[model samples]
Target: MALTFHTGEVGVSRAEVTSIVADALRREAFTEALVATYVWGKGKRGTPRGSGPATLQKILAAEGLDVALAAAVTVLHEHGSQEAYAALHQQIPELGPSFFTKFLYFTGKTLPPANGPEPLILDRVLSLRLRSLAVTVGRETGHDPDGSVAAWVWADWNWSPHRYGIYLSFMHAAARQLAGTDSWPSDAAPDLLECALFNSAWEPSS
Candidate 1:
């Protein structure tokens, strides 16, 4: 099956998700709010709790809606909880619908079609899909044959510098391992190490 990028809705992209989260962190403190909201909801509130839209707007203004959305996605995807989902929805309503649906379609429905791309041969070191690192990808570099596009699609575009650094480090390590540089041949060791040392980080998982 041919790869079809979901372009129907102007809903959240992975880059948007990362951006919202990163901006929220830099603003006031959505992380703390998120934790508090989660705890409060879990206790006795039983949903539809906290400062509501006004307070959420404050958080969004401090951070930015896009940033907040990204943060919410991270919280839900990484943590994986009904409460997390609730926490996110308590802020951004669209996420539970369109954004998440796109995410599901990519991860659950489209992975096999994606993985059909040819493997990255040594001499033909094409772009590697970042989703394969986190979820799944066909085979072409970063998800498609184009490295730049893959990076744009898969790297956490919304993370803070520190968070981005940490993520990049992991990606670098993963690339090295996937490319068979972890145990390079004597004559080719240095080249592999050089490629491994490159920034090798960008994009958001799509």
Candidate 2:
């Protein structure tokens, strides 16, 4: 089946962005550290092109890991045109060039697992604090935050050529956002991988 394309420019407001970013930070305590990720999935297998990955590496090689980490998340939140770009470029020849490639450059290499699921084909993460704010924004904007935001981590191991590379997929609203870890005792002690902006408003399709 052919895919549908969204015409006209899609824009988001700065106030909304600030609200979303702030909420993501407030409700959820910023993660002190998250294990580096690695790609593991099915799809084309080829070393990144000339100076492509290298350029991205240098551009993103921030002095502080925290800045790098935040930038990573920000990229996802902003340039999440993976699906759209793929579909549109086919029709709009000019847009087909290297949009995806550039986007990937902005994103860095996925690191190896931290020590959780064995075949963690994908890992979608989000800040618990952001959940409330997103929910609030969604409500105020008449848009569904759950529908708009979420993480997608994927790895494919069945592609014809490259069969052993980590792939990240945007898993829509599929993370479990908890409070904190167990050993380290504190007020918020639950680990949240994903949390919906507002649970009451969202109902599962039965």
Candidate 3:
């Protein structure tokens, strides 16, 4: 069966999704925002929660940027292992789920997996969109839509280390199929598939 995505207006071809993703990737402001978030641990525009960049700067100051970076790398290396994730939370008790996840996202973007897809941003918008996709993909693949993986990613708000590993696997498969060709745009990257999905879900229909 050919893999496809619903563009919220009509069923969009993979080629169209790839084109939208590619165009988004080429935007200077988009790339700059990602860069700023990765380097500074939060962009100047602030988080989805409305917390300012200054808050992130304060956390970095308190945690020691180098130490925080090392911890973040360790968490990614472990592939979001429960132990590693816990250790990070313990190290920075003040960072709630939203901020911690963002921190992980930025670090993962900075140092992507050597063998697999990079860690995806899991903000509220993306998470909600992914939840919907999980149901669609699960049904298409004949998997239980409300199973552990889906529950972990879609139902639960807190990051589950074990489930996140499963979620990443699903994301990799979906992204590869969506790319539709061997030569996908380098700048776009597979992780941006979530961005494309988010756009489909929330962008005003034209």
Query: Could you say which candidate leads in TM-score?
Result: 3
Instruction: For candidate 1, write residues 62-84 as lDDT tens digits.
Output: 43455654554444445432222
Alpha carbon deviation, residue 167, candidate 2 (Å):
4.4
Q: lDDT, candidate 2, residue 131? A: 41
Candidate 3 lDDT trough over 10 residues, lowest sum = 1-10
Question: Runs in model 2 with CA error above 4 Å?
Answer: 1-24, 27-29, 33-63, 81-206
When sorted by TM-score, best at the front, the candidate numbers are 3, 1, 2
Tell me each candidate's TM-score: 0.19, 0.19, 0.53
Model 3, residue 44: displacement in angstroms?
Answer: 10
> In terms of TM-score, how similar is model 3 to the real structure?
0.53
Candidate 3, position 14, lDDT: 34
C-alpha displacement of 101 in model 1, angstroms?
4.0
Distance from true location, Cα of 138 in model 1, Å: 42
Per-residue CA lDDT of candidate 2, range 9-127, in tens? Answer: 33443234334434544443222212111110001211222323233343234245344345434443444423222222233222111222222222312221222211112111122
Tell how far residue 179 is off in model 2, in angstroms: 30
Error of 3 at 154 (Å): 1.6
